[model samples]
Target chain A: MPVITQRLRVTARLTELARVRQFVHGCALREGLPERETFACELAADEAFVNIVVHAYGGESDGPVFVRCRGVANGLLISFVDEGMAWDPTPPSAPPWESTETEITVGGLGRLIIHRAMDGVRFTRRGNRNILSMCKFRPGFSPAE
Target chain B: MEVKITEYKRVAVVQPVGRVDSNTSAEFEAELRRLVESGRTNLVLDLSKIDFLSSAGLRVIVSTMKSTRKNGGNVCVAAANARAAEVMKLAGLDSVIDMHPSREAAVASF
Candidate 1:
């Protein structure tokens, strides 16, 4: 199948997450990805976009977050680009699972979701732009090992 | 997100509809906190209608759970859709929060 690509640019704000998610879902549907895989891709993209909007700009400047989705080879590739702060993209460790003795706090769940939902993830920095790329392979279409 | 609060077997059941992402999680959190402050300690969040659940939503759940636990109560989850369940499992929330296949089971767990 021919690859289809779609791109969107929005301000680095939390309110823009819904728009981004819609774009991803549209592309996923167009690509004929299964419902479960589409949801996984959407979740991974949401995590990456949220991270960029909340942590990248650092409350100093408002910038645009660019998103690109490509459907190719029975998979989806979603990339997020932002011209905010430059930081490493290492996935954070998940918080302790047992909530018996301590109060559950909020942290590290985004990275965990991103890493777990997407089959492949990569981060790159180039010329003041931070790029996060995630890929989800369709079920029953895995490449030969 | 639209939140509906009802009582089930003495447990406060909070059901949120629509997406619970960064854009809408604050509202969801506020409702949960209000319920906690109203002395409704036990919570069972019905996620069947929620189409999306992001980290922001997870943060609200964790905070609410903590507040309720401090009051000698707890929060449980019920009827999470596939996407919500996947995100919760990825975050290892299944271990931290009690999740039930249905509202009855969640209310019973509490």
Candidate 2:
């Protein structure tokens, strides 16, 4: 089937997380994605949206987060666009599971989860906008393999 | 999100109902940390009631799992409805954390 895409605009607030998840899930369902893939897509979308809501707009006020859900020829494509701070989430580092005895506190692990869940992830800065596109390939339903 | 804590056999079970999103994510993290700092490391999070989960929530789970694991204890998940379980699974956390079908099952695993 050809690619089908859906678009939405969400505010930079945490409350919108549910709405965003719901929107993505709805689109995935309409695109005939399997139950497992649908859930994964929702979560991956949630992570991307949360990053925009929390880090974008300097964490001060609300802004716009543009979301797109599409069924690509190979898999699914979800794009999150925002005019917030540009940050690259892809890094060659694993999550810190190191044993720390002297009490330790660390954050910034959400990006790691996002990077590992989706099949493809990219960050692009165009003018004043930050666009993040993520792709998830259907398991055991590969046309290329 | 609504967070409810229940104690069963010396373990504190946190049941966070509803969606764990941006606005309520911090509150969930705070509650989990409070329990961990107070030495209530034997935690079983009942996610069956949670309809939705975001990365913010996943981060809290990962961090808590690390903290409790380091302290010779661990946080488990009891009864995550399909959706919540899928979120945990997608993040590759299903292998990292202990997940069971019921609170009793989770406690038994510990």
Candidate 3:
């Protein structure tokens, strides 16, 4: 298969999440990914994008968040770039799903979902930009060299 | 996202059609919070029409659940699609929140 690449730049705002999902979904379909894998890819990308829009910019910055999607080999690679604050690699662990306590707690689930749904996640800060790259590989398929 | 609220045996069945992500979760939370504030503590969220679920959406659900339980009521999810179910499971929400296979069962639980 041929390599496919797409890029989108949107304001780091909560309202722009739909556009992000649309962009990712289009890319996933173009890559011919399975339904399950496409959903996983979109979820992972959504989590990462939300983190950037909500946390990276503190919901105040008017900077732009750049997203890039690439279809390579038998997998999809998605990256988010932002000029907002760098994310702390040490995210708080997600609470167990089956806690015996009656009270339910919120937070940290985004990181958990992203890490679990995607095959690989990498975060790095270069100069003033924070780059988060996530990958989703099809089952029983390896990326072509 | 389109949210449809129906009452069954005093249980508020909140159905959100479409993706519940950051873009639409504010409205989703607002609608649910309104129900909770109106003394409607029992809620059954029908997830059958929800094609996508994100942490932002989960936050709203968790907050509502906490609020409802404080008033001797609880929230249950019913008929979530496979993608939604997988997301809920990965977040461990499936355990924290009661999930039923059907709306009738979910409403009955509350």
| Number of the top DockQ candidate | 1
Report the C-alpha lDDT of model 1 over B1-110, residue by residue, as the tens digit.
Answer: 79999976679899999989877888998898888898899999999999889988888888788789889999999999887898888888878888999998988886
TM-score of each: 0.91, 0.81, 0.89
Window of ten residues with lowest summed lDDT in model 2 chain B: B84-93
Question: Candidate 1 vs candidate 2: which has greater DockQ?
Answer: 1
| Candidate 3 Cα misplacement greater than 4 A, ranges | A96-107, A141-145
DockQ, computed on Cα atoms, for candidate 1: 0.62
Query: Model 1: which residue pairs collide?
Result: none
Model 2 chain A is weakest, by summed lDDT over 10 consecutive residues, at A99-108
lDDT digits (tens) for residues A43-100 of candidate 1: 8878887778667886424698899999887688999999998755666664644455
Q: Per-residue lDDT of A25-59 in model 3, one digit per residue for the tens?
A: 88998888989888888888888887887678877
Better of 2 and 3 by TM-score: 3
TM-score of 1: 0.91
lDDT of 3 at B12: 92
Query: Could you tell me how far off, in angstroms, the CA of residue B60 lies in candidate 3 after the best superposition?
Result: 0.8
